[model samples]
Target: MEWLDWFNDSIAYVEEQLTNEIVLEEAARRAKCSTYHYQRMFSYIAGVTLGEYIRRRKMSLAGVDLQQGQKVIEVAAKYGYESPTAFNRVFKTVHGITPQEAKKDGAKLTSYPMLTFAITVKGVHAVEYQLIEKEAFYVTGLGLALGKDMEENQQKIPEFWNEVAAAGRVQELLPIMDGNSPGVLGINLMTKEVQEKWEYVIGVASKEVPIGFKQYKIPAAKWAVFSGEGPMPYSIQDLAKQVFTEWLPTSGFEYAELPDMEVYLDNNPTDAKFQIWLPVRLKRA
Candidate 1:
């Protein structure tokens, strides 16, 4: 099956068994992909990590049960927790209150409803994009492996950039920060499964990078580019979520196994612009 079809099928499976035990590996198996690839593709296409979606769904159901006056322990058991204490801990982490407290005090709780995919058309807006072919470029900067959770990644990425700046590595790497290079590039390395952990580099593009710095060769490929201009990371992240969640599935393309890149356009964080590159191969119509 096609990747998009596989993804839609996986979503249907998740919905069908929302109240049953679901494992990441099992979902990947159903999708006929590796767990890492499945997780990464799901996050890329869903705009949220699979784990986060599951947690939110569970919490939302818990809230519903709490509102219905069901006993906290019974609700917790229905969601697969062995003890109310464990459920309460996770519940409070997501909803900020124990089930009993939520039931007794009528506390306000956040609900993450299951997402429905839809396409909408109103006014037309022009999107600027180009498919360009270029030789491989080397990037040098601070690199780290991120965990499998999107929330954890969102929190750590900014800190990683800050640390690279505070340590003056950006200055040290100035030679590579030429105008053509634009801003620092954030590259996601493609390994096995999408969920499988991979290294991220916060660095600048260079034709000839220094020996000590880790270097990655981005091979010549076609890129679907999107531009974002506004606040620093927020704009960049928002564009990414839109592209993956709203654009990819509908576009006449599917993800190819290649490095995804982000190019910062301006120096100032509050008023910076960036470009997001997604590797693609044309889908057979």
Candidate 2:
């Protein structure tokens, strides 16, 4: 429950900082995890990116402020929008009406409250997983830098995969497979603060950093590897949410500040198999 306390503390911090410039490192410090995994796990468990959450929260408050007679430009500037136009665009998207409408009496508005982390089980049994220590190795592949905008990254990832497939990049990478890690890897180079952009590489474990491919190192650590069968991404994504929200809180381990992997075993249209590797360490008593 200490981790849960810490995770909730992180949320409180995010809520408090919404009116100021949010520093993700501070939130991760409270959560006791890497900025990357803290934000990554947040997206997985909450089914929305941390950025999107923040945006919703800002808009929700903006609606209230507008209803209380704050001018639209003032509300926009308060929420860090550079211009009233940008703020008004997002405001309508969130509240399903313009800021002017939000100020009208008896107008409907949506409120997104601050989130807290808690142990929740969907009546599902313990997720089957294996804890194994892996030696340091390397993966070589094409890399795309992922910025802090989680919603944009969500769309970008599928587009990246589609582009890779359309270009036969997977076939191009198969011959370079040299390490013992299975399948083509969707490796996250999440070794930086959230403010600092990270990379997501679609490649295989190989000793060689071949030309036209970027190479990244996977550090040695114990990983909680979850196996799943069926579909390309949804199956593994669901498993990951279960892992972070259901299993890890009781597993006596903490999410390590390291990169994780998504190993795709097969890419069949109806039956894809995959593994989600999460780096972990024993929780400090």
Candidate 3:
């Protein structure tokens, strides 16, 4: 309940600050979380970026202002837009009409109401996971920079792995996996500078990388490792959704700000078991 309370309060704070310049750090502070973790969690649960959500809410309010006979320039400035053209472009994107049209009688303007966080109890699936601690380790292999489009990245990632396997890169890199973690891993490294993209590494745990291979060291930390069975991708993807929506809010843990990991147990992912490891720390008392 405290988790939901904090998150709802954070959303309320964002709504209150919509007319002013919103500082994400302040929003995170109100929620008692790091900006990165806050943004990541918000995107997963709310299905939009924080900036995008704010933009929509602002435009929604602008539509109301226009309907109430407010001038275009005044409404634009009130919502933090520099010029009427810039405001009209975004306003149309949301409401599908210009600000001038919004002022006319019986104009149907879109609305994005204030949001509140809550948990719904219904048909729940069993989630399998364990809390494990590990020492610092390294993964050595090839890496790719993936854009922020999660749907696109999902398709591109499997293709990258397939290419690696087809070219015998797996066998070439398997020898280097003589470290603590078992099997090869798909690592997602979130770049702080670029929130819209992340670095994906297909590698194995190793202390020393082979020549012409990239290596990344994972810091020692506590992890909540989740397991999924059945078919490739679908099962894992379903489990990931459950982790964020069902398990995480009630797990009493916060993200540890480290690269998340996925461990592959079998060479073939078609119908094998795999694990998703999330770096986390127990919530403070």
Instruction: Choose the strongest candidate by lDDT.
Output: 2
Judging by lDDT, tell me the better candidate of 2 and 3. Answer: 2
Model 3 spans with C-alpha error above 4 angstroms = 141-175, 179-184, 188-202, 229-237, 264-273
lDDT of 1 by residue, 1-285 (tens): 265566667777776666787866677777665555577667766677887888788888889988888988889888878888888998998899778878876588989877654444522444566777666777777678876554576578778888887988777777767567677788877445332456778778876567657766666667898887998768877677677656766678766666778887668888997899887768756
Candidate 3 versus the native: TM-score?
0.77
Q: Over all chains combined, what TM-score does candidate 2 have?
A: 0.91
Per-candidate clashes, comma-separated: 7, 0, 0
lDDT of 3 by residue, 43-136 (tens): 7778777777888999999999999999999999999988889999999999999999999999998999888888789336777789988888
Number of clashes found in candidate 3: 0
TM-scores for every candidate against the unseen true structure: 0.77, 0.91, 0.77
Kindly report which residue stretches of model 1 are placed more than 4 angstroms away from their true locations once superposed.
1-6, 16-21, 25-49, 63-83, 93-97, 102-113, 177-182, 193-197, 207-212
Clashes of 2: 0
Cα error, candidate 1, residue 271 (Å): 1.7
- Cα error of candidate 3 at position 116, Å: 1.1
Q: How well does model 1 score by local distance difference test?
A: 0.73
Against the true structure, what is every candidate's RMSD? 4.0, 2.4, 4.4
What tens-digit string does per-residue lDDT give for candidate 2 at 11-128? 9998998888989889888988777778877887777888889999999999999999999999998989989989989998998999998999999999998887776646466689
